[model samples]
Target: MTFAFDNAPVWLDLLGVFFFAVSGSLLAARKHIDIVGSLLLASLVGLGGGVIRDIILNTGPPAAFTTPAYLVPPVLATALVYFLFPYVQRYTSMLTLFDAGGLALFCMTGTIKALASGMNPVASVLLGVTTAVGGGLLRDVTANEVPELFNPKSIYAVPAFVGSAMTSALWVFGLFNVLTAAVVAAVVFAFRVLAWRRSWQAPLAVNGWQRRSSDPKP
Candidate 1:
């Protein structure tokens, strides 16, 4: 299937890039990093996942580096956030919303990119999850903290999985066109936001030792 360039997807991609960049910059500011450090972190958080996804898909150097639209947004977002730190700091929840939007957009975009590169549905879904969460994983690791996606307390990876699965399902149903992408993106974003609001999480199994204490021996 040919994925044509459309205004909706383009805007969605740019918005995702901008907000993820903002989230990274905000983290840097909280760490008391300099402007340069903030920009570096923001750009990495904005583009790192897409870079990894491209490499894994055997695509050339990342679009963020090759295309001005991809490169410029992160830089601009970082700068804007740096200058608007006070205002942003006052409403941290708004930043969370942006991050969720980024997650959804990236998940959808990554799935489409993988499909475009001739990957199967399963691989495409995995690629989508990777692209959605990879940058944040990189950011946390660089900052010397446990990545949120791996931590039990964080609800990060679940949203990516849901979004990716939805995208893949839509694609499999022959709805892999632009309109479907938009719908999937919106659905993904809505799910993430609702999950965040309600603190919805996946169930974890009790460890063997813990389970033994609660059960009687046969």
Candidate 2:
């Protein structure tokens, strides 16, 4: 496949896809899935978000389907994971780490795409968050696992929101370039990693009722 992207945003999109594919394949390893299943999971998580974004944006064709280059990453990720499953299974945290990297890149790229398609800032931010989390949601659901998005103990979407918001502002101000995008991704990725390591989480149902880390498991 031809390895090409029209712009830096598309490059970010592809890198994000690759990261998400790795995360999906890692989950397949955890579930003891076969190689084919690993490939399918990787494709699902890698392309699912971009497809959802394009569909919502009413783009003629999703970038995942239109660009042959976009298809290569998932395949490569699956192959890598398939060959490294033994060692991969030992580091369970890698699954989320890859997902966090994807989340960071996708939020910025997704928001940029939405805005480029004439979406309002609010809608772009919403679409950005969707593009970051949709694939993981699909991956978990298909694997019979709870989605991080719905997990009260996870701070998944907040980091996406922050990055998307930053991207949107930068785009509107004409300051969105590779350097700024990198800064946004770094901030989001670091925030996500710290949240995971520190066990930081969003609030629960009620006004102030949340299970603290010190709370005993039921």
TM-score of each: 0.85, 0.92
List the lowest-lDDT window of 10 residues for candidate 1. 209-218
What's the lDDT for all of these models?
0.77, 0.89
For model 2, state the Cα shift of residue 50 in Å.
0.3
Give the top-scoring candidate (lDDT).
2
Which tens-of-lDDT digit does each residue in 14-128 have in candidate 2?
Answer: 8999999999999998889988999999999999999999999997989887889999989999999888878767776899889999999999888988988899999999999
Candidate 1 per-residue lDDT, tens place, 1-117, comes to 535634444665677788788878888887888888888888888888888887898778877777789877778977787788887787767656877778988998888778767
- For model 2, the local distance difference test gives 0.89
Clashing residue pairs for model 1 = none
Supply every candidate's count of residue pairs whose N, Cα or C atoms clash at under 3 angstroms.
Answer: 0, 0
Indicate the TM-score of model 2: 0.92
